[model samples]
Target: MSVTDPEPTVPTRDQVRQAPKVLLHDHLDGGLRPATIIELADEVHHELPAGDAESLGRWFAEAADSGSLVRYLETFDHTVAVMQTGPALTRVARECVEDLVADGVVYAEVRYAPEQHVTQGLTLDEVVAAVQEGFEQATEAAGGRIVVRQLLTAMRHQARSMEIAELSVAWRDRGVAGFDIAGAEAGYPPTRHLDAFEYLQRESSHFTIHAGEAFGLPSIWQAIQWCGADRLGHGVRIVDDITVADDGTVTLGRLAAYVRDMRIPLEMCPASNVQTGAATSIAEHPIGLLTDLRFRVTVNTDNRLMSQTSMTAEMHSLAEAFGYTLTDLRWFTINAMKSAFLPFDERLAIIDEVIKPGYAALAG
Candidate 1:
C-alpha cells in the first residue's frame, strides 16, 4: 500500500528565501543599508551614534530594543538625517528595492514622508520624483522580475496630512500607489486628518492608517469607521477587542467583528511590533490569532533597520514559531498582493502568475 507523506509544517530559511513574497508596509528610510548610511552621513556631515557600519547597525537594533520610547524614535533621526538630499533619497530608494528583490519580494510598496526629506532643499515633488526614479532604475535593473511602488506618508502629529494626501493623488499615475499617516497615535487621532481622508475618498484614492498599534481599539475605530482606511497599519491592538474563555470559546467584539467581517487588511509587522513593545515576541504576535480567526492578515517589515529583519527573516521566524507551512506563507503573499494599491489587474497577475506557481514549486 502507498503511504502518505508527512505533513509539511515548517520551511527552512533557504526555502523561505526562495519563495516569492509581497510586501505592503516597509518604510524606505527604515531599511537603508548600514554601509550606505555611513557614506551618506559622511557626505552630509551628519553625526551618527556609531562611526562604523557594523557598529551603527548594532546601534539601531540596540536602540530599538532598549524599551525606551525616546530611544526607539531617535533611531529614525539618523536614517532621516542622511536621506534629506535628492540623490540620497534616490540611492536609498534604489537600494531598498534591490534588497527586497534579493530577499525574493516580487512586489512591494515602500513608504516615506515626502515632507521629512525636504530639509535639504528638495521640494516635496522632487523627493517623490527622486524616489520614483530610483524605483524605476532598480526595476529596470531587475529586468521586470519585480514591481515596486511608493506610498506617500503623512506624519500624524503634523498638520500636513492634506498636503501629503494631495501629493499622493498627484503622483498616483506615476509611481505613488497610495497614502498613509504614521506617528505617535495617542492624542493625535486619524480624525485629526479627516479632511485628508475625506479628500482621498472623494478622489477615489486608497490609503491606510497607522492605527491600533501603540494606541488601542479607539485608534483603530477612528481609522476605519471614522476615516475609512482601506487597511490598518499594525492594528495589533484589535486583539484587545477579542476574548477567549476557559473552555476555549472565542468571541469578537463589535469592532473586531466588523474588522474581520469587512476583511480589512492588517499590515502586521511582527519584528517592529516587538521592538516597540506592541508584541511580546514573534510567537506571541497577534498575527497567529488573527490568521486563525480568518482575519485578513498580512505580515510586513515595518522597519527593517531597527528590527534587523527581511521578508525571509519574517517568514522563517513565523514558520519556526507557528509551524507554518509553505502553504501558509503563500496565503500571506496572496493576501498582501490582493491588498496592494496596485491596479487590480496587476495584483491578479502577480498572484496567479508569480505567487501561485512559485509556492507550488516550493511545496513540490
Candidate 2:
C-alpha cells in the first residue's frame, strides 16, 4: 500500500522461481546465454573479446556497467554478428525460450531488430520466419509451458522505420505481437519516425518506443504525444517531472499526470537502469515511488546478459531494497501481463488461470 508500510514478505527467490512470471521488455540479443554466444561465435569465426564463457559473461557485465550507453551498445554488435544466419537465429531464439521457461517465465515477448540479422544476405522476412520457427520449436520442446511472442524492433538511428513497421504489421498474426523502436535514444527521437508510427496507427498495430532511458522528459513527451507510444521503455526520467512539496506531499507535473491518467505502462528495468546511468541505485529507483503512486509500473530485464540479471534477480533486488512482499510482486507481474500486446481474452485467461493461481500458491 504505502512505501513505508512493511510489505507481505515472501521467499521471492524460491517462490518466484516457480511463480509463472510475465516478461515484457527483454531484448533477444541482450538475453543470449554466454555459452551459446561462444559456440555461435565459433561457428561464424567471430572473434570474441573474451575467450572463455565465464570471462565473456563477466566482460558483458562489466562493459554494460561501465555507465556509457555507447559502450553498452557495442556489446550487442558481437551477439548480433553471430545471429546473421538462419540456423544461428533459430538456435538463439529457441534457447531464449528455453531459458525463460527455466526461469519460470510463463509468458514472454522477446524483441529484436530483424534488420540487424539480415547482414548475411538473408531477407527481413527470413529473419522473422526463422525466429518464429525457433519459438515454436522451443515451445513444443518446453511441453506447452512457455508462450513466446516476437516484437519486431526498428533501430532508432536507422531510416528503415516505416519498412520495419510494415513488416511487423505483415507478421502480426504470425507470431509477431508488436513493434518497437530501440537503440540510442538521446539524438534519435521517436518523432523522427512519424511516418512509421502513423502507418502502425492506421494498421492498428501495437508499439512501445524506447524513451526516458538515456534521454529525459522531452524524449518521453515526443514518444507519447508525437509518436503515440502505447508503452514506454524505461520511462524512469518521468520522475524528473514529479516533485515533492515542502510539506512532504508529492506533486505531479502535466506530463507525469497525463501518463498516470492514461495508464500508459512504464517498463522500468531497475538493474539495467543502473547499468545505463538512468538511475544511480536501486534504492533511489522511481519504481518504488511510481508503484506507490500507481502509475502502471512494471519490472523488466531490458538486457539480461549486459546487466547480469534475471527476472528473479531483479525481483529479489527489489524485495531487498524496498521490502516488497508477495502481493507487490504479484501486482507487478499482473500489471506487465495486462499491458502485454496479447489479445484481451488471452491475457485475461493467463492472469486468471496461470498468474493468479501461481501467486496464490506462493502465498499459501
Candidate 3:
C-alpha cells in the first residue's frame, strides 16, 4: 500500500523572506547597517566602541542582550550620535527603505526622535524633511517597490512630547503617519504625556504609546483607558494578566480581556522582547498564547540591528518555535497591515491585492 506524503510544512526561510510583510513598529535609529554606521561615525568624528563593522555589530548584540532595558537602550546612543545632520539622516532613511524592501516588506512605519538629531544645527523640521526626502528617493530608486512612512517619536523622559506631537501633525500630509512616545517606561509613564495624547485626540491624529513591555498591566491600562493610545508598543506584558491552570484552562484578567476585546493591536517583538527580559524564549513568548487566544497580535522587529534580526528572521523564529504554517505568518502580516496608520483604502488595497496574493503563492 502506498502512503500519502506528509502535508507540506511551513514555508522555508527563503520563502518567508519572499512573502510580503507590513512592519508597524520599527525604530529608524535602531536598524542602521553596521558598515554605514562605521562610515558615518568617521565623518562625524564620533568614537565608536568597535572600529570595524563586524565587531561593532557584535558589540551592539552583546550590550542589548544584557537583559536590561537601560542597557539595551544604550546601544542606540552610538547610532544616534552619527545621525545629527541632514545628509546623515537622509542616508540612514534611504538605506532603511532599501533594507526593508530587500527583506520583502511592502510597507513600514519607522519611528525616531527629531529631538535626538537636532544637535548639529538642524531644526526639527529639517530633520523630518531630510528623512522624508530619503524615503521618497529610495522608494523611487526601487521603482516604488515599497512604501515607508515616519512615526515621530518623543522621548518619554524628556519634555518635548507636545512639540513632537505637533511636528507629527504638521507633517501628516508630508509622509508622517503617526506619533509615538518611547524611552524608559519604568518611572516615565505614558500618562505623563497626557497633554500630547489629548492634543492628538483633538486633532484626530493617530498615536501609539510604548507600554506593557518594561512595565506591567497598570501601564497598559493607562495607555488605553487614560491616554487613549491607538496601539501598544511591545504590549508583551499583557500576558502577565493571563493565567494558565493545571487543568488545561486559561483565563485573562480584566485588562487583558479589554485589550483583546477592543481589538487593540499588540506590537509584539519576539527577539527584542527576549533581549529586553520581557520574554524568556521564543517557545515561551506570550505571542504563542495570544495568537492561540485570537488576540490582535502582530509580529515586528522592534530594533533590527540590536537584535540582529529582519522581518524574515522574526517570522522564521516564530514559525520554528510554534510550528506555524504560511497561513499563520500571513495572519500576522494581515494583522499588521490592518493596524497600519495608512488610510483605510490604502491599507485594504495592500492587504487584498498584495499581501494575500503573495502569501497564497507561497502556500502553494
**TM-scores for every predicted model:** 0.98, 0.97, 0.97
Q: Candidate 2, 256: how far from true, in Å? A: 0.6
- In the range 226-271, model 2's lDDT, one tens digit per residue, is 9999999999999999997889799999999999999999998999
- Models, CA RMSD each: 2.3, 1.6, 2.9
The sequence of per-residue lDDT tens digits that candidate 3 reaches over residues 133-227 is 99999999988678889999999999999999999999999999999999888899889999999999999999999999878888999999999
**Inter-residue clash pairs, candidate 2:** none
lDDT of each: 0.93, 0.91, 0.92
Model 3 regions more than 4 Å off = 1-8, 68-70
Judged by lDDT, which candidate is best? 1
Query: Scored by Cα lDDT, where does model 3 land?
Result: 0.92
How much lDDT does candidate 2 score? 0.91
Worst 10 residues of 2 by lDDT: 2-11
